[model samples]
Structure formats: C-alpha cells, structure tokens
Target: MSEAATLTRTAQKTEHFDVLIVGAGIAGVGGAYHMAKERPGSSFVVLDVQETFGGTWATHKYPGIRSDSDLYTFGYSFKPWVGAPIATAEEILRYMGEVIDDNDLARHIRYKHKITKASWSSQDNLWTLEAVRTDTGEELRFTTNFLWMCQGYFRHSKGYTPEWPGMADFKGKIVHPQTWPQDLDYKGKKVVVIGSGATAATLVPNIADDCAHVTLLQRSPTYFIPGRNANELADTLRELKIDETWIHEIVRRKIVHDGAAFARRAQEEPEAVTAELLAGVRAFLGDDFDVEKHFTPRYRPWRQRIAFIPGGDLFMGIASGKASVVTDEIDRFTEKGIALKSGETLEADIIVTATGFDLAVLGDIDFSIDGKTLDFGKTVTYRGMMFTGVPNMVWVFGYFRASWTLRADMVAEFVLRLLKHMDEKHVKKVEVALREQDDNMPLLPWIDPENFNPGYLMRGMHLLPKSGDKPEWRHSQDYLAEKEAFPLIDLDDKAFVYK
Candidate 1:
C-alpha cells in the first residue's frame, strides 16, 4: 500500500468517545455506571490493562488476599454486600463482576488496553490517549472530551520489595505477595513473611494452617485490631425480616460511624487508643507473650493504616504455635534463612515479602497539557478529584483511613454533578483555577502528613498533587465532611473556571 493508504489505515484505528475512563476496577466501574446513569447518552469507554474487571481484586492473587476494611463501607453504594464484612479477593471480584453485569458496563470496557500517554489539547477541548495492547503489542489511540483516571494509586506491575543484603545468595525461594506463584507448594515448609502491614497480617493466618510454620518478621511493629468478620447488627436485622436496603443502610452507617469514631479517637487520644488496642492483643496471646514489644507501634494510631485481623486470626495462629512474630531488622539473608540484627536467625524454606505496594499517581500515565508536560507536585489538587489547571479530568483518590470505595463513590457522585452542571451551562471546558487569594493559602501535602503517614504515600508524595489550606484546594479525609460538602458543593464557586 502507498504511504497515504498506510496513514489512513492507522487513522482508522483511532477511536473517539465522549469520555475515557482509564481503568475497569471498582472505582472505574462505579464511575462508568454513574456516568451512564447521570449523563444518559454520553458515550464513554473504560479501558483496563488487565484482561478482566476488579482492579486490585483481579490483580492480587496471594493467599489470604481480603478486604482490610468492612464490606459495608468497601462495597459500592448502589450495591448491597450480603457477605462477610471482611471479604476474600474472589468475593470482592465477584462483587465487582456483579456490579459490571448489573450496569452492562462490560460492553463499554476495552480490556488489555494499557494507557501510556494522555495529552490534553485546550484548542480542541479533547484528550488524546496512546495505549498499547498487552497481548498483541499493538499500539492504539483514542480521543475523549473527558479523562477519568480510576487506575488507582499503586503500581500494578510490581509490589514494593526492599533490597536485602545477600538476596542473590539465598538458595530458598523468595516471593513478593503481589505476584504469587500459583504452583509453588508450601504445605510442610517453613515460611517467613516480611513486613507487618495488612498483607502480612492476612498472609500469616491463612498460610499458618497449611505451612509447617509461618513467621512474620517486621523491622518494627504495626498496630492491629481484632474484630468480628461479620456484622452482628446486619445479621440481627436479617433475622427480623427487615428489607435488604434497610439492612445495608443501617450496616453502612454503623461501620462508617465506627470507623470515624476510631479515627477521631486515634487522632485526639492516640496513647489511650494505642493502649486499648495493645491490650486486646495481649488478651488474645496471653500474659506470657511480649505484646508491648511485638505489637506496640512507634507511630501514633491512624498515622499509618492499622491492620485488622478478623476474629483475631493472627493472634490465634500465634497462640496455637502455628505462627510467630519477630521484631528485628534483617542483617542479611543466609542460604538457610534470614540473619537478624539481634543476633538471631529464622530458618525458612521460603521468604514472602508482604512489604506493600509502590505508589503511582494516575498509574504513572504520562500526561501533558497542550505542549507542556504537567508537574503534579507543582499543581494543587481540586477537592481531591481534579488538579489545578487540568481540564475535564478526574482522579479517583480514596480515603487512606477509611474504606477506599467510600471516597470513590463520593468522587463519582461529585464528577457526575460537575458533568450535569456543565451540560446545563453549555460549557465545553471546566478547570479548577485558584483565585489570587487562594494562591496565598499555604500549600500542603495532598493529605496532612501528620494525619496520614503511610509508607507508600510518603514515598510517592512528590509525585502526587498538592493541597491548600482552602476547602476547594484541599482533599478532606473526613468522610462526613466530604459527604456533606460534595452534594452541596456550588458549581458557581470562584474556584472552578468554565468555558
């Protein structure tokens, strides 16, 4: 074919839609559903790098992969979660699938389309995206009026694994929890899980029942709360023959309130809350175990995420001698096991790094506005959704302290409201532009560093957008504050610029 024919064929591959959502995970699915319902005929497509729906759910395949928060808050608002409060990865995936099926969102999803770059053109009022097909290695292009980034905050390609000394010399199998090897058997093999985050908490109990022994080795200590996996109130309401909707609403309120109260207590009276939490750990493990040394955290409560082990499973495993905790730094990795800084050694057949995830803003998608590349750290966040001077784009950033879906649903609702207002006003472009006075306000981290000090968040703080002292410029982690502010937020506020 001639050069002109080749160019024509290439142009044919580029598709255009009213909106392009850069994920098909829970947030993406919820965003798509809300868009379809609120906008009616507005065309949109949800693209995911993975071949299936359920972003985190589909990606994480490690043993004991489950919800850190209760399903009442974690699950979408439109859907009612009738399962255990702490749901398994498969259950969460099934829930996501149900939501997609209910909304007919599968028809609008293009799987395995990994977005590489998205460039916004102010002149054309459009975003042009370049993506590569994971399976075929085919390049593709797309254009949209709006770009919704629900790709999540963490890097999906790999989990965070620290480089330990003599890693290459270790003859035993080493693995990261993010990418679990399916065929590897550890039925009678001793395993050492590194890190004391939520992933470690989940893995210890789940793997303990099968492994010869499971040891959780952490540099320091992390706060953990043991709670029931099922909601007793919901069960009571069900037995009373109450409507499912009512049950869902009641349970959701209770969970949210409980979560809020815990956060409040953690921030206001951290020492007291810390003591109470540690006391619970002592009760589970008995007076003989050194709860204060192994369970007590150096940081204040709510400063980092507190791992919740439903029904005290981790403690049970430890109590039953199936699992153990080692609070010490790794000196090095020997062929037999890991040498500790305290002159101790742990014998293990396998090492599982539950170290956590690598944070990525907008899935680290390359973004440019017109001809200029965007610097997120320099730009301020607009209500935790859009960035300053960024037009027709929304980023789904959830609450670090609460369930992720809670903030996701709120953002979706806010996005829909913005779209509706734009439609009513006949505006093609909408951007969050700070006023002169707003610019004078102190620019802080996306979340107050004091309120949230998660390792992943702290590590990637420079890559994320900033926040200001002003309400419009700040991203509030308080669910109640956002719950009231989002629906009642004035579109006519001086913060937003429309054309």
Candidate 2:
C-alpha cells in the first residue's frame, strides 16, 4: 500500500472512549478502580506501553529490588497489604496482579500501546491520541473526552547514567540497574555498585552474599534509617486472630498518621530528627564505624528522601566484611575498576550503575491545545493535579516525602468529585484557567529546589509546571494536610472554568 493510503487507513481505524488512561501502574490501576466505582456507566480504557500490568515493578528486576516506603502506605487504600512492610518486586507484582484480577480491570487495559501524542480540541470537545504498537510498529489512534496521565514521572526506557571519563576503556562489564540482564551472572565476582541512593543501598547487601565482595562507591552520603522488614502491628493482629479487614484498616491508619507526624517533625525540627536518626545508626553500626565520615549528609533529614534500611542489612553487610562503602569522587574508569581522585584504586569484575531515573512528565507525550503546542513550564498547576489552561485532564504526581499512593488516592477522589460536578452542571468542557487576579500570585517551581534531593526531580524541575503561593495553586506534599484539604476541597473555586 502507498504511504498516503496507509495513513488514511490508520486514521479510519481510530477508536473512541468516554475516558482514556495513559498507564497501568499503581496510579493507573487505583485511578481506574476509583473512577469506575464513582461513575459506573462511564466507559474507559487504560493504554500501556509495556507488555505487563505492573509498571515499575515489572521493569526493574535488579537484585534486592523492593519498596522504599512501607507497603501499608505504598499499597492502595482500597487494597490490604498483609505482607511485610517492605516487599520484594515479585511480591509487589503479585499484589498488582491480584488487584487487577479482583477488580476485573484486565479487560480494560490495552498493553503494548505506546502513546506518542495527545491533542485537545476545543471545538470538538475531545482529545485525540496517537499511539504505536511496540511489536508490530503499527499506528493506532484513540479519542476521549477526559485524559488521565497515570504514567509516573520517569522515563521507562532507561535509567540516568552519567558519561564517565574513559568508560569504554574499562574491561569489566558495566550494567545499569534499570535494565538488569536476566541471565547475567555475578557470582564469585567483585562488583562495584555506583551511586548512594536507594538502589545502591539495596544492591550492595543483596548481591554481597553471592558475589565475592561488593563495594558501594559514592560522592556523597544519604540519610538512612534502620527499620524492620515486617510490620509488628499487623503481625500481632494476625497472631490475635483478628480479621484481615479490621487489621488492614488499623495498621494503615496507624502508619499513615505516624508517617505524617514524623515527616512534619522532620521538616519543623530537622536537627532534632537528624540527631535522633543518627543515634539509631550509631547504635547499629557502633562507635568504630566512623558514621560522621561515611554516613553524615550535608542536607537536613527529609530534605532529600531518607533511605530506609530494613533490618539494617546494608550496615550489617559492611560490618561483616562482605561489603564496604567508599565516599570519594570517581576520577575515571580503569581497565579493571574505578580510579578515585584520592589516588586510590579499587578492582571489580562488574559495575552496576544504580544512578537513578530520567524524569519524563506525562510519559513524554506531546500535548497541544486547539492545535497550539503547550509549554508545561509556562503554565501553572491547579492543586497539583490539573494544569492551568488544560481542560478535562489530570496528571498523577505523588508526594515526594511520603508514600506515593497517598496523594494518588487523593487525586482520584478529587477527579471523581470534579467529574460528578461537571456532569450535574451539564458542562461540555472544564478548564483550569488562571483568573486575572491569579496572575499576581507569585509562581514557584512545583518542588522547591532547596527542599527536595531526588536527582531526577531536581534535574527536571525546569520542565514541571509552576505553582502559586495559594492553596488552590500549591501542590501539598504533606499527606495529613492533603487528607483534610482534598476531602473538603471547594469545587466552586474560581480557579476552574466551566463551559
């Protein structure tokens, strides 16, 4: 067939839905479940680029991969996490499968559908999406009145790795944790894991047992707090023969409240919290470990995410001589290992770059309104869910300081309430347009640069939408504050415009 003919046929093959979701991860799954429960009659479909249902859990298969936050808050509010507080990737993936099966959401998800662009039309009162099949390379199109971006804020293709000096000169194998090879073996080999974030923390202890030795090389230290792998409260309830439902509720509430209160304390009294956190580390690692030289970070606690070490496994590995931590700058790659600026050399058979992710908002999908391209940086966020001048669209960005699912649940509730209100008013379109008075409100980055310490977020802050000083414009990172704000949010606020 001719190119023009194929294009015409592809355009004719467009499908339509009442609502369209752009991912099948935790956010997408919960958003779909909530949407269906709120508006039973509405037709919707979730389009995912990956072959599986679990987004990150399915993709990241590195050793010792697990949840950074406790599953009580990380897991959906509607679902009960009866397992350990921190869970493995396999366990979490299984939980996701259970959620999909229990909710009957499998029928609504279209896998291998990579969305490329989404355009909104004011005259037609709908959104047109262009997608491609990964296996076949065939084009597909879809249309919907409401677009929900549940794809989390990172690129799925690859993790962010810096270009080191003379990387190709190294003789050893170099691998990124994001795309860990299934068949690659590291047993009896010396492995050097780069970066000091959660991935590095998890990788060192996990591979330490199998490998001859593992070295965690980092330029700086991250705040880490030793925590139990299992939730004692949940375990006690189970031992007492309490019903799972009641136990789930009690444990979830307790974790949520405690997490919120602790975060507040960290932000309000960082020094006290920092001292308290370091004291626990000292207790575990002991006086001879040189905690100040190796573990102390320049930033205050909770400014950057506090890495949670379940059972103090990382420190235990270091103390046992199976693993070690080196805090110094990497000068370059040598034939067998990495060379440090301090004139020290470390040998390794394998190198794992546990660097981080490349933040990609809205799945890097090109968005346009009324045939005009939209610049996200130029626009402002509406309550951190919707963006100004964007109509019938919601972006699922969670709290950085707390469990990601906490804010995701709130966004689901707020979207459903907004949809219901729009239905009652018989509104054709709902846009979050900044009023004249809103222009005077000082606009700030979605996340203040000085406040958070995640690498990807800090690098992509310029690409994110702006926020104002007011409640309607600010994105609340506090889970407890949002619990109150989202429940009593004013739907009739001047920030939203209906037609």
Candidate 3:
C-alpha cells in the first residue's frame, strides 16, 4: 500500500453511547466495570484500535517484554494476579483476556474501531466521534455524552519510528523493537538498538544469545536500579484466603506507597541508604568503566524513569562481550551503518531504532468543547483523574514514583464514585473550573515527555504530582491517601459543577 493510503480516513456516524471509553486498555475496562457495578442504569461502551481488547498486551508483543513494576501493585484491586509476582508479556495478556471474559465486556467493545477525533458539542453536551476499520478500510462516526480515554502513553499498535533523517539510507536491515517480527530471526546478526530506557534494557538480554553482537546507543543516561516480581506472592495470598482482594489491595498499596517513599528518600539523600545500592552497580561495572557517566543521569534519581536493572543482566551482557553500550548522538545514517556525532561509526547487519515513541497526551484526538478546543496544555490536572475545565471526562494516568496500577486503581475507584454521585443526584454532566483558587493549585512534574524517551505521545511524565499541592494538584503518588480521596461517598461539591 502507498504511504498516503496507510493514513487513516474518518468514517460517518452510526452508534451512540452514554459514556464512551476510548482505547480498551485496563483503565478503560476498569472504568466500565466500575460504571456497570455502581451505576447500572448508565449506558457505556469501549472501543479499541486493534481487533481485540487488552490494549498494551495486545499491541506490544516484543521479545522479553514484561512489567518492570512488580505484579503485586500492577494487577487490579478487585482481581489479584494469582500466578506470579513478576509476569511475562504472554502471562499479562492472558490475564487481561480473563478480565475481558469475566467481566463480559466483549460485547461492549468494537474491535478494529480506530477513533480519530472526539469533538464535544457544548450546546448538547455530547461528543461526535470519528473512526476507521483497518480490515475493511470503511469509515464511520458515533456520538457519546462522556469519554474515558485510557490510551496510555504509547501509540495503539506496533510502531517503530524512522523519524531520524537518513533512516532509509542505511544499508542494514532496520527493525523497531516495538514491531519485532517473529519470523525475522536475529540469530548471528550484528544488531544495534538505538534507545536508552526500559525497553532498551529489557531488549538487551532477550536477543543476546541470537545476535552475534549488540550495541545499545543512548543520547543520555538513565538512573538504573534493580527490579522484579520473581517469587509467587499470589499463591501466598490465596492460601491465606483472608479476603484475597482486600489483602491483595492492602499489600499492593503498602509496597507501592512505601517503596516509593524509600525511592524518594533515596534520591533526596542517597547517602541515607541507597548509596551502597548505586555503589553495587558501579562495583559490578568495575573501575575502568565510567559508571558515573554512562550509568548516572543528570536529573535527580527518579526525575526521569529509572532503568529497571534486571539482576545485572545488562551489565553481565556487556561483561560477557555479548553486548556493549554507546552513548552518543546520531549524526545521520549511512548505507553501511550509523554515524555518531563523535565521528564514530558502528557497522551492523541489522539496526533497531528503539528511538522512543511518538507520544499522544490524549491519544491524538482533537477534543473540543462547544467548538472551543480543549487545549490540554492550558488545563491543570484535577487529582490527575479529571482535568480542570474539561467536562464529563475521566482520564486515568499512572505514577512514576510507584507502579502504574497503583494510581490507575485509585483513578478507577474515583471514576466509579463520580459515576455513582452522578447517578444518585441525577446529574447528567460534570465540569471543572479552568482557573485555580489561591496557592492551592500545583504545576506537577508528572507530565515530563522525556521520562520514557517514547513516541512524542507515549511519554506520561509531566502529568505527575508535586509536593504541597492539593490532591487535585498534588497527586501524592502514595496509595493510602489516594485510596481515601478516590472512594469518597459524597463527591458533590461547588468545585465540581453538576447538572
């Protein structure tokens, strides 16, 4: 197909929804489950760009892809992962499929329905939407009263960026880790991965045995730390049978909240404790290697994403001569290989541009209210769940300090409470004021786009919280406080306008 032909064209309208949850990921499904449970009278539906549900799981099928965060805090509050603490990509996908099956959410979801735009009609308080089906190339349209977009940080499918000029000039076969084809064997191929985040770290060990040599290229360093959910915490919880969900949630909340506290403290004053931990990585790397330069980052420890150190697998890969790290800016690409700013060139049979994702804060949807564009840039996050001045919408973005599900779980609960309040009070719509009151408003650091080095739309930082701000502004990134703030019995207030 031609490149122009590959571009999505919007279709005409057909269906309607009381609530339309975009991107059928965990957040979208979780919100639907809550709505069904708390306010059964409310009509809802979810749509995914893919042919099936399980947004992240269904999309990213890379080799050795798994959660860097422990499974204890990653799974749902109502549903505890009964298998393992750390899970494989396939395992997580299976679990998500189970969530879809158990909740009977299949009928509510329309696969291959790629939503292109969501425009809110102020006069009617409804959003007219656009969609395209990949299989048929058919166009369609729909409408919804409210929208819950859980598209997460990445694009909806397997995307590798050839954004850098001269990418096509490279003589070597180029592959994006996100779009890793199962049939394209890397065995005995000299491969180079051009990225420095979690994906890069994880990809290193997975292809080591197959590749003749692999090089990880990075523009800047990320703070690296060891992580995993190796053991079976799930079996222990089941054996106890003490309200499995309750105990599971409690433990998840505890580990995430407390562990983040430790990480924060470790950052503010590494000498207080984790100095030895940093030293551990340095010692493992040895004196000849400049650990402080290649390993240590410029920002405070967790300011950016701390690379998940998988029990020294990456370091061991380097030490074993199977892999090497190259910190340099890419000047351009040549037919033979990639040339760096430092005038160094690396020859390779295959190249992997793990070069970050193209991020979409609100999933690239042109959202507008009453013909007035909902400039996401102009709004402050109200509790990180709802945006100020945006009406009848709830977005669930997780935490960098803790596991993604920790904040996601809280956001899900908060959405439920909001839905319940709407149901009880007979309120059809809810809107937040764009302006702030006094010094209470906070400009959080959670929305930093550079944290993950993902696609421009995939980075979920800068959307985070800051200290001393209201829970509306200050997302504590803590579990207990978030839980309390989320499940409020009476959410009606002057701040939250109801109609």
What are the lDDT figures for the candidates, one per model? 0.90, 0.89, 0.71
Candidate 3 is scored at a TM of: 0.85
What lDDT tens digits, residue by residue, belong to model 1 across residues 277-384?
A: 998898899999998889988899989988778999999999999999999999999989999999999999999999989998878888899989988788888888
Candidate that beats the other on TM-score, 1 or 2, i.e. the better one: 1
- Candidate 1 RMSD computed on C-alpha atoms after optimal superposition onto the true structure: 1.2
Using lDDT, rank the candidates from best to worst: 1, 2, 3
Q: The CA-based lDDT of model 3 is what?
A: 0.71
Candidate 2 global lDDT: 0.89
Candidate 2: segments with Cα more than 4 A from true spot = 1-8
Residues 1-499 of candidate 2 have per-residue lDDT tens digits of: 9999988887789899888988999899998898778888999999999998788998898988998988888898888888888899999989988988887888999999999999999999999999999999998899998998899988989999999997999998999999999887999999999998898999899999999999999898899989778888899999999988888889988988887788878889988998888887888789998888788888887888877899999999998999999999999999999999999998999999998999998889999999999898888998888998898999999888788888888899888888888899998799888888876889898977777768888899889999998877888777777788787877777778898
| Model 1 regions more than 4 Å off | 1-3
Best by lDDT: 1
Task: Give each model a TM-score.
Answer: 0.98, 0.97, 0.85
- Give the TM-score comparing model 1 with the true structure, all chains together: 0.98
Error of 3 at 307 (Å): 3.7
Question: Candidate 1: which pairs clash?
Answer: none
Please give the RMSD to the true structure for each candidate, in Å.
Answer: 1.2, 1.7, 5.4
Best by TM-score: 1
